[model samples]
Target: MSERPVSTTDLDSYIADLRQLQARRRPAEIPDHVVYPAGEITIPAHVSHWAAQRPATTALTFEGTAFTYPELDDLHRRLAGWMADQGISRGDRVAVYLGNSPEFVIAFLAILRLGAVHVPVNPMFAPAELTHELRDAEPGLVLTNRALASTVEEVQPRLDSPVPVLIVEDGWADAIAHEPFTGDDGDLDALAALNYTGGTTGLPKGCQHTQRHMLYTAASATTATQLSAEPGFTSLCYLPIFWIAGEDLGILLPFVLGGTSVLMARWDAATTLDAIEAFGVSVMTGTVENYLELMARPDIGERDLSSLVDPQAVSFVRKMTPQVRADWAAAAPSSGTLRESSYGMTETHTIDCVPYGFAADDEDLLAEPVFCGLPVPGTDIAVVEFGTQTPLPLGEVGEIIVRSPSVTDGYWRNPEATADQLVDGWIHTGDNGRIDEQGLLHYLGRRKEMIKVKGMSVFPAEIEVLLAQHPLVESVAVVPTDDPDSGQRPVAFVLPAEGATVTAEELVSWSRENMATYKVPLVKVIGALPMTATGKVRKHELAEDAAALNR
Candidate 1:
């Protein structure tokens, strides 16, 4: 697998080609419309429909085991019964503390089948972090693997309503008896799941989602993947299923749409590409970091990836130099159309997606900083003046506010935070972006100081506060520096006590010990960060300074 290098000119030429393609026919002029059937029911029905109609079709490919629709359905039924037998009644919360295995899928559907909320906890979460969500959700039953079972056991002593941890494989005999004998009949008003935010700041909060919402969103997302009518479309499911947005759109949507997925334990670039070729995957979606690493792989170009398709998001596109954007796109294996750019948070149920090949006039400028494209159907996107809640003009940048059916209701229990985020039915998406005349959205920056490092969200304020607690440190400021591999990496600027000397590696190690690996800064130093009149760190200046340091 030899690498294929594309030039800046070649990149620009392709953008020009894409512009010509867009100018030839407008999306509005195409006269195509999506029509959904009336009386769309809840999620359990959708799953049941697929199970009945395509019982023999491949439902999931996980760990070399290809589960047929019938097998998948039976697993869900047995799991549902198991939940009931374990005293998990309808409307109860069931936390699935497992990885991307058959058990995760079965556990999720089973919880929904019994009309209970399915809270999928991140398997990568530390015990303290897992305990927080456990306390918040207060699930009656938790499904865990052998590896995570101990974590649950350790945290059980600390939680108020510590529930029974059922090891899926080891406790199969005990769990099967609890299989939900009831069919796909349940209340739609019941909660579907409580998706917690990836807490870089404090404890993750529960995002309340219902069965109807998940079903509808899954249908729309299914269409978005272009898998509605396309049979045998292979999807790559690597991200943790705990994140409701990715699980629904990336995994479940494709399944319900009659598509296949090549499951992995986690993201391994080499393994991912090999699987793409091995399973004949057509569509792959992940953060920008994932793509960059895959592209940089030693033999990326030689891989038989003729089946690769749409990319949901790309990070480097937003920060790419004009030449680099074109270069990157041209370099992307032309097997699948990188047709869209999605800009959304987990809270909005992953709303605000924009398709590529829409804006012709701004193609040159647009290609430089990745444009998020236009809002999806049945969505209203607005760039409003900060703090005033007033809509901005066409090209003026402001806080992005979205109103849509996909928008989550609110944060669970945290009424104060919920009140702050949800105001007047408009979700204040903390991203900064502007819309062009043709309604294409271009991402500017984030409203808060949260930095998206690799695909992980890292808030500098969280790290700075933690480091400030150190005895040797007087002041600290963390700023994001660009990296070709990892979209962004944090570099800490510290003002130590007078003449104290601390190496960057030592500071980095110190941060690693105190926080999550992603939360720690990669680079650390001894110096005071530039500040303004109000004593706030001059972040923009620090960014420029970091750029110079890199040079």
Candidate 2:
């Protein structure tokens, strides 16, 4: 549906008009928490609370500038008013296509403030990739930075209806400089966010999460992490905000607790260290590769990391080795509570299984197989038979199925896929796991093939689809190979066209131009791809071959 476009002058004029009339609710009356007091929770409740209770407190710090709680609230709500003035209301989708910046957070808050669904589009996506998600989400408005606006412009002509794109200039000061939106609170049961994740079929499916689902996740995370309002928590937001896990920690968890998320322009080990010392950064969540880089730094030991506390970090893809843990303990000894973070996916809102109280020496971290701790509040975990609902014995390895209040009802607009992954309110997470005798969940690995490159989700099918588009490429099978730094790297086995002379470097160069750099595969010119009897590409065999070739 087409939406009314709004201008800065229009928003100001509308606010002046509203000043003459009275409304049912005022912004000051809104509560501080939307997560707690369970039944009465909304997406923007926490922002209102923090803005009222601790207006001057630093809510978010980026580069060298900081936005206090009230400052952030004022900007977001006014932006919401501007959107509302455009008749963009509940159920309308708004795409946030910016990087990890304050603009991303403000736009996200504004969308939810208007009861609109938040669609966090990946900033790394190319035109082909961007078109797929925009087509599916059907955003009425697209919020992007100046540098990325061209990508949106490129994809505009290809969409069913061209979305109105707002390129942020000077922190959207003029765009949001109006009276605040003191409209009604968000409906907890209504759709709030659409987190897009790549599937086995090669398309990114949106995981439709309601406001209540977000509330439950925030509540579970609060209890699990022991977050409180007394002394506000502060963490780094170097992680990609588009990803569900990153969004939870960076935006959801921090705001829900009235804490500050010091945002970095990008990941730099020295800068992360500087932030830790500079901002008294309390918690840290990152990859094993990130930890290695920090530990590898000779000056890391010299850095004052006393403020980095209660760090039960989440190291993804490759497991965090004991040596790495020992190194961190030795280097940053002040981080006493270092251990595994939580277990979750986009559909379940990440934080499904939380290692809440697990310490460094606890069996939770040193388990034989990887441990995902216990299920969060109002969530149940069952290890079922592979591809079936039959409950397996506690020790038997099976597919981990989760039934949680926080679980998404289904994928957005895809009933067939919803039926395949979600059954009877139980999310069939295609992960290999088992319940130990002590009732702790131990994760084995992925039953389905979803490769992770430096903690970024990279589907083999998506890579293969992109590679197959090459003119010289007859057929391609993408599989994961061992990577010391990135955990796992995609290795493509390409069957070239007859008499075609295409170098491996040419295919790699082509892939770099098409997809995200992390998703780009190391091209290998092969005579044929291993196939099943039905002529399907045998990915597992190709994976083994890739490992052998790497060795």
RMSD after CA superposition, every candidate: 9.0, 11.4
Report the C-alpha displacement of residue 264, candidate 2, in angstroms: 1.7
Which one is best on TM-score? 2
Tens-digit lDDT string for candidate 1 (71-92): 7767778878867777887779
- The local lDDT score (0 to 100) that residue 394 gets in candidate 2 is 61
lDDT of each: 0.67, 0.78
RMSD of 1: 9.0
